[model samples]
Target chain A: MPEVADPEPLPVPLARAGDPAAWDALFRRYQLPLYVFVFELVRDESASLDLVQETFLAAVKHLGTLRDNAKFGSWLFGIAHQKCRQRWRQRTEVLFDEIPESAGEWEPGPDDLLIRREEEAGFMNLVAQLPPPQRAALLLHYVEEFSLEEIARITEAQLGTVKSRLHYAKRALRKLLEAKNENPA
Target chain B: MKTPRELLLARHRAAEPKLDALRREVVAAELNNQATREQSFKVSLVTSLLCCSNKLWRELVWPCRRTWAALAAVWVVLALVHLAQRDGSPPALAQSAPTAGMILTFRDQQEILNELFADRSVPAEVVRPGIYAPKPRTETVALLAA
Candidate 1:
């Protein structure tokens, strides 16, 4: 058999200067992860959606300022973080709305579904208690599967700061879970 | 003894948000809206600027350039006349002594008015009493009675 070179990865669809389809593709690809990341930080489903929308709107207005198209995911998240902060500043109280029933039906074995739901609720509660930066760092690091450097880039923080936030967030979450287990009420 | 981070990660995989139909729909709609808005706004802005510049050059600048230039020239001539008047010789010095004497008489009348106003002991009644009346009605009645 003859040896063959590996094909290159497909180029990311950047929202071109005025290409609506390209922008749509980029948004479809990253919106979920970006929304989840913002949701983890703010802990409110509706507010997270609003933040995501505002972030995209801002990105559209200022897309010319972005230097690297390849780093669009991180850039979008950065804008989302700024919008999240603005929302927080404007309204200090945070409200965590239950996930909409429209989020669709879950089909799993009964035990598995129950366990998963409990875990998700517990994890979300823990995440909600974390400070904004630490929560963002943890979500990007673990949930979004971004590396330390990527988290730093997205959060516009130093690499060490990102690492420290993740470390502390994990420790805090562990302690919280342990406390919950001990109480069991 | 504590569990490692990787172990915790494995245990929590199911807790993540699933790619459900509704979620997908919401994401698609939001993305579509964003892309459309961005594209439309950019196109509109470019079109508006182009239209504005074209109208300015064709309807405004070109049509008004001659009028603007003529008005500018008139303004320059008026400015030069004022400047010349300021820098030219004193007309007072060029006048005959009789004309200068008339100017001195005008100055004397002004001086008399100033002195009359300034003199505290001179009853206001002696020098244009009606002129200094506090009320118009009193002066009017006095004039009518007179």
Candidate 2:
């Protein structure tokens, strides 16, 4: 099947002014990436969907406060992060790093392209193991292509803190991968 | 298979799970939201005045577009500053009666007033020399009211 070309993200002014076409463009541009980010934070697909919805709605409501158009992606991610926190507050169980030991068989579907490499799945599992802040910083750094400053703004952490989260997260992931390989469990 | 940029975006799109129905649901909800916002946009008097002022300033006063915008922004900042200062200034300093001197709390003020009025029998001069002169009941009370 041929892939359709994605449209550019709507400019901030349009979304801030409540344009539906702009909103649709924004939703299409960020939905997949946001789902991935939120899903890593909270492992349930249904919960991720709700969180995504809540995040978008909150973004819409508070769009006026956003001063810079370039930072919309970080702003949206920040809202999703807040939603994840809200969900964590509501729930009692802790399952941030608990993927099944055996890899699940991939059903023939669209999302296969993201995990096309086997190690991509391994990478994601290790990602799940890191603490929430570190995982967020790493994902924002690598997956979302955000700068340290952008990550700091999104996570509401000091620049030094964001830098450390990325550094520590990478170190911890490296250790986990090495341990996994040595043992081959 | 378009440009390299398009290909990259396509890969990102591929990360999206099969959720055509969900996407439809979200889009429909946004359209509904737009409709509701459109319907709810009955401009209040203040909003109309603001819109009209903005238009008038842009069109006539300093029609150089950018200049007028800057001027309007400065004007708004000045107005807001004036309003904030007006609101935050100590009004009680000017408005409080001299006779109600140095009373802190409402309960304390009430107690002092009770003590003063309870001894209504005291000749008005005793309270303050010449300040509270010997006077009929109505005159004394009237002076206190003032």
Candidate 3:
């Protein structure tokens, strides 16, 4: 994939001062990205829209908690991630961390080409099938192109846990691809 | 062949246009929320100031009205007493300047006394110095012996 350019810096101080134009500029910049991240995780259009709005509103209310303005993107994603977690918690009693780690068994090489254009739909299907934690880690790491530390901060996971989840998720995806390729059904 | 990141981004790109309406709605909501919060803050501040002023009046000023009136009455009485005393007293003259009549009276009394004493043939209204007046010789000798 071609590298995406860095977006214009957000007007964090103006937004903090409750300027409508500043908040609008911020929403315009992050609304789509935040929606995509949330929609991909939840797979519900309405929920994704609501989550995006909620994330913005949450940003408005607790903007003072953000210590750095340069980190606005990750911080906004972090709020969406937490909102998704809340929804998940309400729907189920299952714990996200208890999912077993298969990362130990699979050591994917640096040059491994795990995805292809033809397998795009299959790849997303398998990704959606992944557990919430692993899927979140993968999307944040690959799709959002956040650093491993940024992913950890966004997901509120440990650095090692983020690494492990990314490793395990990719390994699982590769296995799914291999299985599909072998069967050819 | 596209990478997973590229494929995912393309897939989600379909939904971007649909979010324009949502953007307008969210921005409107945020602006409205901010306006409401600012209005409430202003109201609360004004209410607090009004409450503070009312509390000051109730606690400090209204209850002490009797004491304030009594203080005013005392001041008025002191002022009246001072004015009455000032009105009754004689106006003072400068002590260094005496009137012509007072100087003339003083000089006349001194002259009369001096004249009476100087002429010993007239009975001296001023008592003559007894030691200088001639005493009888026998009385003087007897006085000396005593």
Candidate 4:
């Protein structure tokens, strides 16, 4: 399997050293993907844009604290994830049940479930309906192509919790797809 | 049929141009934020350093102000005394050492004083050790006779 690369190899070292061009390059590379992820989670364009800007600002300020420069993408995603969580907390008090961070039974991963082009809109709508944590996990795992470990780090959840979320999220998506197929409106 | 990744990408295709516009805004905003943060950090650093120096003065210097003043006064007095002693020292004499004629004159004065103070009755010949002539006192002769 080919290792998934971050859109491009960012000049993290120069950016960390406070280079303006390097910072611009880093933000340019990640802006779209970061905006997409934030927009999907928050569903507000202005808020998402603000969060993206906030995330980049934070990345510029604290880039020195990031130990591994190679994991800059996941690290940036982690920042945006925290921003979304903060926004969610401010907007509503939605409580999530405790998810057991234990090894779950075998299940079909998102990769195994083929999504047809026609079902894209319906699938995204279903995805939006998932619980915030599950949606974040699914988006990070499938859409952003982050590994389970990366998703766990980005979400600040246990590795087992990440796996459980991915498992349940894909299951819920499949059910929604089936239901939509049966009631072809 | 497409993978979920491709489908999601397709779903977001419409937003790319908007994202492109937002990119310039985000970059500009981040640059401004970074500037503000750096400025705040510099200000905080200066404030902390000033606070630290003040604390040091209060803890280490203010408590011993009297002792330090007394020590400074003693040093001042010592410096003044040293300067006064340096200035008050006697000047060197201008005259050279005494000549041989001065030494001969001193010896002649000493001889004349010894002669003037000698007994006139005891002549030089009578005062010789081998020709000793005894001049007895009357009281001594009477006692000897008795």
Interface RMSD of each: 10.0, 7.2, 2.3, 2.7
Tens digit of per-residue lDDT, candidate 3, span A1-185: 34444556679999988888898888777776677789888899888888887888888888999999988889999999999988887778666667776445324346345566667788988888989998998888766678888998998877878888888888788888898789876
RMSD in Å for all candidates = 17.7, 23.9, 17.0, 18.5
Q: What TM-score quantifies how close candidate 2 is to the native fold?
A: 0.52
Error of 3 at A53 (Å): 1.4
Q: List, residue by residue over A43-77, the lDDT tens digit for candidate 4.
A: 98789878987897788778888999988989999
Better by lDDT, candidate 4 or 3: 3
For each candidate in turn, the TM-score is: 0.47, 0.52, 0.68, 0.62
Q: Compose the digit string of candidate 2's lDDT tens values, residues B74-121.
A: 999999988987988577778767564454576697998899878557
Top TM-score: which candidate number? 3
By TM-score, rank the candidates, best first. 3, 4, 2, 1
Which residue ranges in model 2 land beyond 4 Å of their true spot? A1-9, A93-118, A176-185, B1-20, B40-146
Candidate achieving higher TM-score, 3 or 4: 3
Ignoring the other chain, what TM-score does chain B have in each prediction? Answer: 0.32, 0.21, 0.38, 0.41
Which residue pairs show collisions in model 1?
A: none
List ranges where model 1 is wrong by over 4 Å: A1-14, A93-118, A176-185, B1-146
* Top DockQ prediction, candidate number: 3
Off by over 4 Å in 3: A1-3, A105-118, A178-185, B33-42, B60-146
Sort by lDDT, top down from the best: 3, 4, 2, 1
lDDT of 1 by residue, A1-185 (tens): 01111143213334544555565555656566666677666667677767767776676667777777666767778788778767766787553221121222212222111123334557667777777777777776554456678778877776666766776777676676666668877
